[model samples]
Target chain A: MAFSAFASAPAAAEPAVRRRSWVALVLLLPGILYLLLFFITPLVSLVFTSFQQPVIGGDIGQYSAGFKWENYTESVTQYLPLILRAFGYAVLATVLALVISYPLAYFIGVKVRSFPLVQSLLLTLVIAPFFISFLLRTLAWKQIMSDEGPIVVALKALSVFPNDGHITGTPFAVVFGLTYNFIPFMTLPLYATLERLDVRYIEAGNDLYASPFTTFRKITVPLSLPGIVSGTLLTFIPAAGDYINASGDFLGSAQTSMVGNAIESNFLVTQNYPVAAALSIVLMAVILVIVGLYVRRAGTEDLV
Target chain B: MAAGTFAEKGADLELVGITKTFPGFTAIQSLDLFIPAGSFFALLGPSGCGKTTTLRLVAGLEEPTAGRIVIGGQDVTATKSFQRPVNTVFQSYALFPHMTVLENVAFGLRRRSIASPLEKAHEALRLVELDHLAARRPGQLSGGQQQRVALARAVVNRPALLLLDEPLGALDLKLRRQMQLELKDIQSEVGLTFLHVTHDQEEAMTMADTIAVMNKGEIEQMGAPEELYELPRTAFVANFLGQSNLFTGEVSGSTPDALTVAIAGQRLIIPTARAPRRKGTVTVGVRPEKLLLLTSAPAPSSGSNALGPGRVIDVSFSGVSTQYTVAIPGAGDVVVFAQNMVFGPVVHVGAEVWVSWNVEHGFGLEDSVEEAAAGVQDAAAAQSADADTRTGVTSSVRA
Candidate 1:
């Protein structure tokens, strides 16, 4: 009787289970289509483009392209320094942003939990600059660091440099602007991770005889490392590709011109389609390598 | 180096008039207690009875509003929890998720101003029989193993006192029973002054040498488990500690050893061994198991002070016993638990029965109903006065 009852119950419930599976498929179809159309297709095209060379006066006018290993070789050898420099700047900016934002995030997330008003005020201060146009914010930095600006006058008064002192159009200024622009990106994610952290872990550490500093280092830091890695990636990737911030604030000085400037010059001002495409593909490859290494080191779980 | 050495080193802990008041509620009210050198003492109560607050006060996780706490004869009332010579196993275990079992156990020893970490941690793990699973993280271990890791972590410090707050409340019934025995055995082996707080009466009775029954931020009674169960001083203590059938009556006469009370128009004599200030209306408390069920009323048994004819209202067959609810004339229902001797015949509902107990089996309580009623009124007035004082202090502090 029990066997018959079980068999009948499953038979009766099969249609409901099938209906639920159908509903799941219907809900998932949109996201699946979006990934295929936008992400997968673009990634395949970029890889294919990286290995191809543009042919002038081809039969198809613009469609015919042949595989060329020389493009990859020339780009690596000739433009490797610029690529490395861009990565260097991205790393420096990410590190600086992380160093400055960690304590701020920790303070806002953990220390100021009892003071909602203060916490909200701090969060607003961190997020307020984003509300303004990014170009205008970067332009404002250019004005502030000009030779006639207050910063130069202050520097002159301090006898820290020549009386005609100015930090405008310098690599230092570019890095400073990138760090300032991306600090909130680093801080907000870190704040979220730290805020959701179970305080019991820290209390457990204390109970187990860990000093406050030791507990923070061993427990809080390692536990929040996922946020750190994600925040770094979020900040660094954009900062490396930030042409507007770098060129607008630093005035496209040669030393400060990153891969972002190279891409802008090739695509817009220079209007060299093939070279621009090549540079875009190369830049994408470099970013992919950096991100892949980072993801591998930090574990993909950190991204989610 | 040895168990109970901390007690020999000094008295483990003392709390003098500890009080904690929150925004509009008083959690603990002027509690004075002392945990001896190496006893498994339990602060047992229902929810909202301030047992956890008492534990927190001893752990230095809470600052008593008006009291002093001393551990190992050293004043630690103002000290931070980290600075105190004590460790706590929180209710959830609170095992550090990022740490392995060995690291969790080693944490306290590593923080010690004295003692080598490896040696102390090893000793602690060995004590809890968790040395083999030391490499695994708390998440990797079973619930029972995680609990032992927490125990090892706390004991590694050899703190003056160990505070366990409902450490086994999260475990399943079988695991909880096993842990009860394990904890009692561990306490005996370590001989640490354990101050455990729990709401489970059975858990406290089974594990504690001394049990303090707390109610509404005050301890109703504190004594050895057997004494507290066998001779509870008040209805609250008797009911809170275990199930008891209480009969309310006015004391008509008293002797050195017993008292005669009129309960539901029936005259009954009750022993007064643990009675407190017994001159007025009294409540006679008798455990369910103490009442014997007879097929026929025995010829007025000697030393038996109470006899009542009752009808068995309900019979429930527990695994080891049959519990019968009996109703006496003019009196409310009383539960009578009888051990199942053999399957002779079941006591069916509506069966006529005689329920009686020896005078020595029951004790009388000075009526606390009036006092409990008055206590509510006093608490309200006190709350209002406290609010006023707090407002005054707030304005003053603000100014």
Candidate 2:
């Protein structure tokens, strides 16, 4: 009986696999439809709208579809500084978050591994910030760093800033908010990678006569490259396109506007659909290029 | 003492009163050991018996609770692992995955500030026959190849002592056997004190010049392989190293060269040298190969021959030897191994036969608690017995 079952198992495997593939296709239908409806359609419309020509003396912001590619050039000419500042702030925040999170992740992952309670407690603390609304958290920072806040008052009294100067509505405040809010994004990926690192490799390094620092530089850092790349990607991508942290009504002033704020104002306040779509397309393209080059230089495969 | 030149002479290692205790359990009790210069020493035991712990202590990876470790006549008990003149081939092979083979082998030399490390690293790789794969990373090599790389990486430094912690355990059985011979060849060519730790009894018996069998964190017996297998001191050693058929009986008489004991109305003579020191009631043991199964009882040629009647209960043929299980009247089931040197009549189950062996083959140990107390005092006295007398019995049994 067992021999017949074993001999017939291979004959039955083909139909089972064919049915499983069909089941997989059925399982993937909803996700594929959702992407097609929400992502691909809007992406196509955005590209189409980017090449539209504005009506001459039409209503406030009416435009018609045509080969008027000047909309792309005009959006770039008007919002180039904002675009550059957005990417600059994102780069700075990603770097700052990585610098702050790598050691914290290493401590939580490796140092406290023997203490299960303390390790989980620290990991929960790293993720605890996500319990609150991100916009509300940015608003809270706004109130804390306002001119009437204790920090600004103390800085004024210490002559760190002039009496009339204020920290609100500044690039520094915008960068600080981005760095503070995205730190968890950078930390989780790093922690996940470092948690699986084998301590025996480090011991082997020490046994081979490498000093502690030399071991970290030669062994730990290289082995943790995948974590560093993924962490920076998670922090940098969302930060480049975030509008609430850099809006004129929030941390930013008119002078500190970024591409996200420009796109928001153009679409809602000014109602310039073509220019807004053009600016959004430009931001996405520039980020894709930068991330591709970064990942290539880091020598990792596709995104995490 | 010149740089980059390995000394032909090996270093002597000594451990004095070493003890290692964890938070609640002691891994090793107070222990003392000595490995002479250039000798291949092995620590063999089952799992969790502190063989690895003892090797780690010698490598300076674990600090002993109370002891001094001396190497090459220098007190290195306080030295850190990196500063100690030793290297270990880790059980996991722990090769740097990111570095090329040459770089991994040259890592130790670079730390020592040796000049032209690549040249020396290539030389080491050639010794392991891995020089052609020098540019490849560790992940690209096979398991056996990676093992050789680990060996090369450690041996390049020419540390005073080379510690192998189950080095060949990860390979397939055939490869393990081949590597054992190669490892023996490497140790002889390098002339360094190699301290190997393994749980495989055959591996220890084949490679080590001196074998220490540990049990529950202490050495049960330490001697040459033949001496340990032929003449074990305790029941634990006798059972652990090989199979032993034991019979507990009272001593009826003693002479200059034989001991007469009565068991279930039958008299047996045991060699005096192999007899227990305190001979009231003792456990007599003989290896399975020493007991012979015959169709009938033989004539008593001398007082040093033992013969007993039994019925064969089981018979098994294992290529070169035939095994028979015999049930004597009071000896329980006794196992015997008969050599298949010629086309002999095969014994079947339930057949009556006689079991026999020379008197010199039986060894006795004190079985009762009262005699065992006196046995402790006679431990040193037993050691005083001449080694030549032991060789005489072991060599005759080998023939």
Candidate 3:
């Protein structure tokens, strides 16, 4: 029954091809409708809200329709330091994620390749954090960094921390949560690239008088650049705009409040629609610019 | 040159009592080989026959279970691949996909920090006629072009020994033949010792100065290509190197002229020098091209061996020659190849025919010692043995 529609009249071959395109267009209707209703509508509404002006003498949350572009300039000026701080935390988190993930990905992809079941078990462990709510995981980190927790107490015991100092509500805790939550995103892409790396290329390099370290530098590093580029984008884009880790309800204190926290407060606490909309738009634009510059610099066209 | 230094020219390679064993089985058993400087050598065998393992041992990719490898009088068995002065043209051409062809060729030079690596790399590229494509990546090139890039990459080093592991296995037949001549030319022009490993017999014969026929983790025979083909010492060589028709018979007697072998109530004389075994049961073989077909028996001649009155079972026409399979009742089907100087096959199927050959062309092998050399002959032997069993004479029964 499924193939019968495809097996239309042969004498009308041209018409059948035309009809086939119509059938393909019909199959696309639901996705197109969903994108238009959910995505395009919200995006246009957000852009409209970013340009809205506050009513000179109205109640809270009231605004007038106008091209009051000052909303962008004013909000960006007020939150410029927090915006830069968000970017700094995101960059640090992405670098930490990469440093931790590469070895784990390489271990799964190249080292345990002959033991596929063990490799798959390790891969499942990397992904197993997703099975629980990240919010709950963030709370768990909160507990782990509490005063009586082993990590804080051990650091105090080791003299790495001043005995009188504390651990919770620090920038380290917020960045740690971000890195922990986004590590699997960094790892899976790197694994996909490394698993398909032909060992023969490495052997050829070795045979051509390349020391193993030189071969890793010349061949392995360049080949995995595509993975690093994509993994960085995946981690950075989310980490920069992530409110969960930087919210006062989570890891952040007043000192570590990132742009995401400020935007959240502007919308819910202050009931300021234009500033919230403006902040979200600015976050997306800056991420796009950073990603564009990164992809161009990395010089790999095979991005996924 | 001493232990790690290389001579300016190709170096003689010596493998003394090389043995390699895996966990499950022995790959190569107690093998010794010597290749003179600058000779193109081939290790020819079927898959699982340890030819590739032998190549890996020499390349220092796989350590031998027990052996010593000496290249240019320097013991390289203990050295890593990068420390040894050896380069390889790998099977899939193993070119770096991320680098331009020029950069791929320059990789080894850069590793050693050689002066003017790119200049030298371009010169090597020009040698393989790939200089025009040097700026492009290997992925953009065709299989043939990538093959040339690999050749250039290996040849640029000018190592004392160059290892090629089935380098032409990926090309089509015409391109493989073209590359065979090109590879031979490069070897001679560079004057470097080449040790090529392959499963293709014709490829080995076409390119190598010396061919080592390996079977079952052992060297069956090693000699010049034509010498191995013409005077193969083992039945495995006779069957594996090319087509051979084998017959088992008792050594009846000898004349000053030749030794006589009696088969099915007929006596066939082979030269004394041609027969390896002078007494008891022996297996004699003649190449297919040396045999001719006749519709009727001629008056018996003293200088010939003829097995006859067989019926033609099949005939196939190749462009250069016509091949016929003649089935003798108590003897196996004998293959005959005749040149196409005339039209079609000289005889048709189901015709009575006599298969004849010059007596000097036949060679005898020891049947008792070569019981393991019965693989390719088993199919034809089983058929004839069945027929002999029906008649209760059993002329060729070794099992």
Candidate 4:
């Protein structure tokens, strides 16, 4: 039956198209098996765990496999503030990353293109942070904003910061860390699209009575939509669940704890396996929903 | 936005002492030109002749190093491109890939705060016979379709002047021919000043009301197509515009009606009216089609010049005409294009023949033999790989 269904397609297509072939199936088999083993299998177990219940009078970290629909509601009620804060921080970081990366990408990809050496050097600077570990970078930022740090001490002397005020444990620090870590993700994709942009389209926009700013709004932004969409996805999805920047050991403190930190503490220290799994599932679902709405609203399928 | 006095109707364009110098070389020398409103003018030349630069200066995309640009009796030298009454159909047909055909065409009207942009866009699309494809994206259209869409997008604004920068260079030969004629029809219908830049000689001849032959950042000659082709005053114009059988020599004698020049002791007559004004040495030539070849010496014909007894070195038979390369005793090879009329005997290679043409068909140039020889070399180099090289340079300029 499958063969019959597939037979009509290849027969109609010209040979040049090569629409169906066993070589393709063979090529895809490794990827499919790899995803099933490494990614999908763990995901299935996580879903099952999200629906499990704790054992009555049992040891810590032990659970009974059963339907527990109340687990979702219980986790949402207990850590509601953390979940909301996680999403809010992610949105702020994504917007900041977009604004900062666009100009940098434009400068490197289009403006300095005539000087190849300068372009390469600027691109290297953007990617240089990746050589260091993510946790190390967050820790470094924490030290730079500490009370005794050079920047904070200078700000205090200038009366820019309060004498007794602290920079760590603030929402601003966590968001700043998120934006900094994800900026390369935004810049590289934006550069990929902007580098290949045909200048004539922009010139045509100017020729059609669009001012320079208007041309940027109508022509350059629309042409770079693909990059913007991918960059935002890269930033928002990971940032929403990030624990390092919000953990007490890094840029943030207990007041700034996100959904990730809550899940980590429950899973390891508190040994509340069901609540941790439920919280994890909630975060995933929330990200998926927001991303779906965003992609649909952007309408980049036609723009690119 | 100092476009307060902008004229919606077609407007004349004038360039006074315009010059543009790039990093290594001057693209346009100090020059002055005036183009009347509502006329279809063409700038024709080989690659890198600065025609595109001149078009950019007039479009206000490039500022002249030293000159004033006037349009419709207004000095617009400092006006920005967006405020100028000009639009360009780029060589690559640079349509916005994100927008649909109708949206792309309506873009300008919307920018200018004009009402009912969609209706006007549809009307322009119908003018180009592309209304049926209005909803399709530019990326989905074929080259010819995209070309028409680009044209429609520019014409929808009804700018006083429209610049076409080798707009059909990307199409196939047959499609380019079709678009040439279609563009001519659109030009007449719109009654706007259409400044077309092209490297294709046949296209300029087929579409342009007037053609300017440009060489090395300067206008060599400008006139009606037939006039320029028949009586080119410069060696560069004669060779660049079309194939010429140039013979360079010192003037042997002169009469009230004609001047005779000696090449390898063989004399050829050029009408005094067609001779270049400055007198010492002269280069005279005829178009290939104007030359006739006879297997034997003709009985002395009136009002004609004859060069004799040459051996046919090569014969290439095209459908409508056959080209023969004849090697004269003292002169270099001269090319003659003979019509392939039915019942005419075929002339094979190695045949002895006499090459001849009417005296009125001969035109003289003051440029010497060295200049004509240099022109022949430049023309040979330009004919091959000219199209891709030019388009590549244009696309890379922004970088």
Which candidate achieves the best TM-score against the true structure?
A: 4
Candidate 3 Cα misplacement greater than 4 A, ranges: A1-20, A158-160, A302-304, B1-7, B254-258, B295-302, B366-373, B377-399
Clash count in backbone of candidate 2: 0
Candidate 1 CAPRI-style tier: acceptable
List the DockQ of the predictions in order. Answer: 0.24, 0.35, 0.36, 0.42
Cα error of candidate 4 at position A121, Å: 2.1
B1-399: candidate 1 lDDT, tens digit per residue: 232223233146888999999989999999999888889899987667899989888876678999999887789888777777688998888887766778778776666644567667777788778888877778888887788888888876767688999999767789899888988887777678899998778899999999998878998789999999898776677666666787777789888887788887777777666567577777777899998887676666547755567788888988798899988886688888898897833578888777788778887665476753343344344445545855986786555
Task: Evaluate candidate 3 and give its CAPRI docking class based on DockQ.
Answer: acceptable
lDDT of 1 by residue, A1-304 (tens): 3355547777877887666576778999999999999999987775566555556665432433567656566756765666777788889999999999999999998889889899999999999999998878888888888887888888898898797555877778888888988999999999988887878778777665567898888789878988898899899888877786557435336767777777777657755344545666788777889899888886636321
lDDT of 2 by residue, B50-86 (tens): 9999988887778999989998898989987777778
What DockQ score does model 4 reach against the true complex?
0.42
Once superposed on the true structure, which residue ranges of model 4 sit more than 4 Å away at CA? A1-22, B1-7, B295-302, B344-346, B385-399
TM-score of 4: 0.93
Task: Sort candidate 2 into its docking category.
Answer: acceptable
**Candidates, ranked, lDDT:** 4, 3, 2, 1
How well is each residue in B15-123 modelled by candidate 4, as lDDT tens digits? Answer: 9999999989999998788889998999998889899999989887888999899988989999889988898999888899999999999999889877789999999
Interface RMSD of each: 12.5, 9.1, 9.6, 9.4
- Of the two candidates 1 and 2, the one with more favorable TM-score, higher being better, is 2
The per-residue C-alpha lDDT of model 2 at residue A173 equals 94
Query: What TM-score goes with each of the models?
Result: 0.82, 0.84, 0.89, 0.93
> Tens digit of lDDT per residue, candidate 4, span A62-108?
99899898999999999999999999999999999999999999999
> Ten consecutive residues with minimal summed lDDT in candidate 3 chain B?
B390-399
Angstrom error of the Cα, residue A229, model 4: value is 0.6
